[model samples]
Target: MTVFILVAGAFTGPHVWRDTAARLAEEGAEVRFAALTGLGGRPGGPGETIDLETHVEDVVAVIDAVTADSGGEIVLVGHDYGIHPVLGAADRRARSIARIVHLDAGMPRDGVPALAAVPDPRLRVEVAERAAGELPPPARDAWPRWGSTAGLSEAALDGLTALAAPQPLGTLLQPLRLTGAVAAVPVTGVLCTGNGPGVEMLQMMVEVGDPALRALADARVAFFELPTGHWPMLSCPAALAETLIEAASGGGRRLTAADASRPPAHLRPFLLDVPERARERAGNTDLYLPDGPGPHPAVVFVHGGPVPAGARPTPRDWPTLTGYARHVAGQGAVGVTLDHRLHALTDYEFAAGDVADAVERVRADPRVDADRVALWFFSGGGPIAADWLTGPPAWLRCLAANYPVLAPLPAWGLADTRFHPVRAVSRAGRLPIVLVRAERESAEIAATVEEFLTEAARHRADVEVIDVPDGRHGFETLDPTDGAREAVHRAVGAVLARLKG
Candidate 1:
């Protein structure tokens, strides 16, 4: 007999699992709903008293009773804020659990509080400062603030608001500590596609060489995708229950880690064989100077990534960036490349500061024409274009994106306005923007480019598009066809013309 324990997230209790738990039981599985303290009909005992530990004990008590009677391991499921306590309990009873399910939830790291779960960094800080001990759930109309309301009906949302409880500040503020014991446990991730990134997107990032994301390739980790939103239990209980059953049975899609021996796409040789020019390093930026007697226009290439913090041959060293810089220099313009702290999605603001700083340093150089400069972004570096779109400077002649990700993906984090080029493009006014689109681009990325184009059109933003129908993302090294080569040539020429004009 399979045993399953369901733990609901913040502002919710076991009640939210009623339909799903019934479905599990009907399938001949013993289902237990872990009623958290201060939630699920439990009273909020005191200010800040019902923290992560309080909820952990609540879950552990259920586990102890079930295992004592059956003398067998059970599948443990955690959703949203509930995952925090579920993990805390799982760590203590690692041997008692068969599989741990991450249901539309972020992987909580050790020492990080659930506060990081808030998505938008700026709003997270504000929420932290205003909370004394407990956090009241948002109003009925505001329930969408916490999670997407995609499939929820008006009546369902009404019930959600009515049954919600005050989430204790401690539950989010307290740090989660792990013993490394849980790593040995088999895992299943139920990715809700409508709410955020699905497994496909994660695998794409992994293929690009993010060491931090390599854990997804673990053989013990399996995945299932739901065509719903964050609260899958409430939105599509039947489908979610079925997925949960499959997850408990250790049946789901498994990802293969890319071969370690081969170099990542970025490190591969440049597609075009351009003569190498001497490089000069000033702080985090690298300069490829043309053989000219006077100062020349500059094109700064911003490489994409939330690359692993320790990645070697940094962006500045990547063959892709170096190739572009050298090609730009060969065209009689200075090619500037820089390393930024975009080690994670949250570091965009920090990386933007690095990009801004590098521009200053490059502009100050005697070899560069400070008044004529263009910025080109690649891959994940695309959103940084927002900063220049709004009130572009006189010296900022052009902005270009190559297979750029113009928006934040679902479930990765909050949709911070800081990096959304689609919303900020209206302010771009008459500033020239060049877009290099890939027909075989990832769905998530292509969607963002489409969104930016739609918004730019509505606002009449001055924009030009160059299509690479035969190319994929990172086409330079990945696609060696003539189409990819010509697209690259055209994109560079357009940006160069803007700088020279």
Candidate 2:
């Protein structure tokens, strides 16, 4: 039987999950309700010095206790504020967690606190107002004013109010610390569709490019819609139980190349014939060639990242880049995904040289139409390939960059240099370039892309700008949400069209 750990949101205790827990238990699943410190029956009370880490520890302790008792994997479920602590626990114990289910909860990113995740200014103000003076917890009776409890039966409302307690203000104020460990653990977002305007609000945030929401949309997290209010366990216990069961039973695993039963017939991996000088700096390249290849138009795929030193290549490393290469091959083109040596922030010039060598190798492939080769660069790779965009070979047909970081981040010791794309685009030749900008990228990147385009126009470079509505940076690699997938497809199509023309 699967072991389940259920965590309740703020101002609520394990009793809130009584119905859901009973249902799961009836199905022969072992359920453990985690009543966090300062709430439920745990020691500590309101006005105590409870911070986010304290609750994180509380949940981790529960996980450890349950693991000791059951000796099996755990399906951890968190709702509302509970998601923060659960994520912290999961990050600390990644191997012990089978899956994490967020039920109508706020998704917090690394270093972002729960309160800051709230997009509504008025709500934030209200929270601050409520926590003024002694940092007293919000009144339990006022819970209805903060979120929707509509559609809930009278008995459910009574049960919720009776069990609700005061939540620690520090939990919402303290930021979460994550080191990308949670990415290894599968996650599921259970959207409560009937929860007033919460669902629509979340969708709008995603469209506007909220980072946390965008991360939640990652390919790693599968989303399931449930027609219930915020308190689904109280209002729709049976349905929530079923969803939880599905999540625990492998519904949350992100799709990876290893998940493919057979290799794509059209795609094959190859080691580029790198020169002795470049061999040590070069990485293996994956080639996707269509059948009947007679000097086909080709695309060289440049992935984003100043990949850290000592990092080993894995099939999971660049899913989006490899996936896009296959798509290009399906369109009757030679798609080459190359791995170039990455350097520390100070050695970008060396990295760019590696990328240039990779490009040369791709152009030399017998199956490639040397004269019609195009280049596609993503994120950090944009700067490395910017030199080619500026003074591209006459044989180079087109260039495409997706959410490219055109300028060096001076804060990270990457000051403006001759290699900086934004600084060099003005000197670039009249190369036809397509820039795909994610609408919701960081302000720094957005400004850089805009500046690059402005400079390109000033230089009379033929550039086309494509704005991915509601798109996030690195959306291609994240969960395959409809919006993300559409953005990637559109960008690829635009680049292919420019190359074909």
Candidate 1 lDDT over 160-187, as tens digits, reads: 8899988888888989888888888899
Q: Say which candidate scores most in TM-score.
A: 1
Clash numbers, per candidate: 3, 3
Worst 10 residues of 1 by lDDT: 409-418
Q: Can you write out model 2's per-residue Cα lDDT over 171-213, one digit (the tens) per residue?
A: 8788998878877998888876544223333343343333434
As a whole number from 0 to 100, the lDDT of residue 95 in candidate 1 is: 93
Error of 1 at 260 (Å): 4.2
Query: Model 2 lDDT vs. the true structure?
Result: 0.70
Model 1 compared with the native: what TM-score? 0.87
Model 1 lDDT at residue 263: 74
